[model samples]
Target chain A: MTTIIVIYGLLAVCLVASLIKSRQKTKKAFLVAGKALLKMGPSLLAIIGIVGLTLGILTPETIEKLVGAEAGFIATVVAAVIGAITLIPSLIAFPLAGSLMRSGATVMTMSVFITTLVMVGVVTAPMEIKALGKKFTLLRNGLGLVAAFAIAGIMGVLL
Target chain B: MIKTLKKFAIIIILSLVFIAMAIWLPDIAKRSSIVAWDYFKEMIIIMPPVFILMGLMEAWVPKDKIQKWLGNRSGIKGMAISFALGTLPTGPLYVAFPMASSLLKSGARVSNMIIFLGSWAALKIPQLIVEIKFLGIEFTSLRFILTIIALVLVGKLMEFLLRRKPDKEYVLPGEGN
Candidate 1:
């Protein structure tokens, strides 16, 4: 859409400017932004806005229809449990969740799915273990999975 | 210069693949329309502040402080602090990894660092606000409790495993590849 294009365009410009400023050494500029951006306030603000949009778009009715009542509840927990061991980038998870939502997936299911998608990351296990050591990675992810499920279940009950 | 070339090549390839998918898969375009727009907009708005924060962290937080906080000998207190700190609102997982890596290099226990990074993704403050707005307070509170417990347990488990036989081959940041 127009919004997407504009945003990407702006990002491209910023990236290009940064690259040029660093004397065409793309990595230097990109890395600087990449590292510096981690602590930047705008990034947090944008995250807030995105979270708002996601919440606004997701309706409770959408939750009931996608997963069904009983099955949906079960699915929520299952997804969380499974998510702990699986890992994929947010780019994939967001689209997949959106597609599912459009196709009539429940909000609860989507919530659980999204939570697990980032939190559990079983797929990234080997890489994480390698980088941080095996035992620590496993334990952290394991805890994340449980938290994802708990969050989903509690949300389901409250909302 | 070589790194620049490699980066350029990677970027070009990635862009091409993206374009190819966009053209070849019409469904992707249709499906991702609203969500993608929303995500893009969100990213643009938030990126500046996030980058600023990253700069601040780089400028202010010293390597020694991170080490002392999560050092190997710190025990349970260290893990608890790491988890608490990780729960703070932050950026994507990728952003947290480098900081965690730095901690690892500075004498932080691998288990504690892992817990910190894991919590960074799972228990972010901004994410919590979103959950509260959409889901309600009770739900968010319970989730937080559960996530904290899980992170702590995992951290302990990792410690036990590492002690059995530490892997010296694993690369910590700044150790060089």
Candidate 2:
């Protein structure tokens, strides 16, 4: 993907710059990276497992059924909760939202799904807490969930 | 050994669950492993460079510089920089976490980092293009505006609350290295 390429390119450029400027500092940077990577290894594996479970169980068809079965306020809430829980990649999530919209899912529900999908990240919470601490993770996600609903409500009303 | 096992308890439990599913629910287990393997591949590819970038920032960028650019006094300029950095074509939200952690250690404001994280997750350019393609321009644009507004408010609120009771356990492993 473009993202992977961009990151590799950025890393190559930055690494070269750092090496040319100060090989000692570049070496230190690698040390820091290695240590952090080692520290995060367990959490990363857990995250992978969770992502797999979430996506496998809540495939697009299943998600469609869950969101489409309900309407009005209930559907919107279910959509938001599902969005918050799952960590669907944007590539899959956006297109899924589009199809769901076409298939008679309400605009409010789709908007809620998209907003929560992007803004929240329940599955990534362990890794996030490890890096940023529990308070930061909790507050950011808590606020994000609230904001997602608000944004979805406004979008639903406006569009 | 016990400490290490405890640290890895979650993974151990997950592995057991996978095994259980394989026996009782073979189909779901196969599907789950496939999905997990796919993501594990992606993570393996992406994580090294991301951590390297974070390390490079830590070593090369001076703390005062980060503080001046993204600290409390950074104001609108800080927000702009955070927004621009966030909108870059980074891979995922998890990648941003370590980088944001580095920035926090270097004295960036909580609110600015929130903006950075929020934009990275919600308002990246590539993601917007995809949104427009699938969801239409009108819907994409409206959501964009609303998201931006909501993110700023959320960031400010978090900044205020954190300032009141700063998290004492923000340190990561291998600090003082």
lDDT of 1 by residue, A1-159 (tens): 333354346556655554456544445434555654433333333333333333333333343343434445666665454444333334344455555555655556766776776676553453354345665565566666666666666656665
Candidate 1 stretches with Cα past 4 Å from truth are A1-74, A81-115, A122-143, A146-159, B1-20, B30-65, B165-177
Best by lDDT: 2
- What would the TM-scores of all predictions be? 0.54, 0.96
Query: On a 0 to 100 scale, what is the lDDT of residue B125 in model 2?
Result: 96
Candidate 1 lDDT over B41-155, as tens digits, reads 6567645544433333443357667666777667788888888878765545644654664467666776677678767876767666665665556645765675666566666
Cα error of candidate 2 at position A154, Å = 0.8
Docking class of 1: incorrect
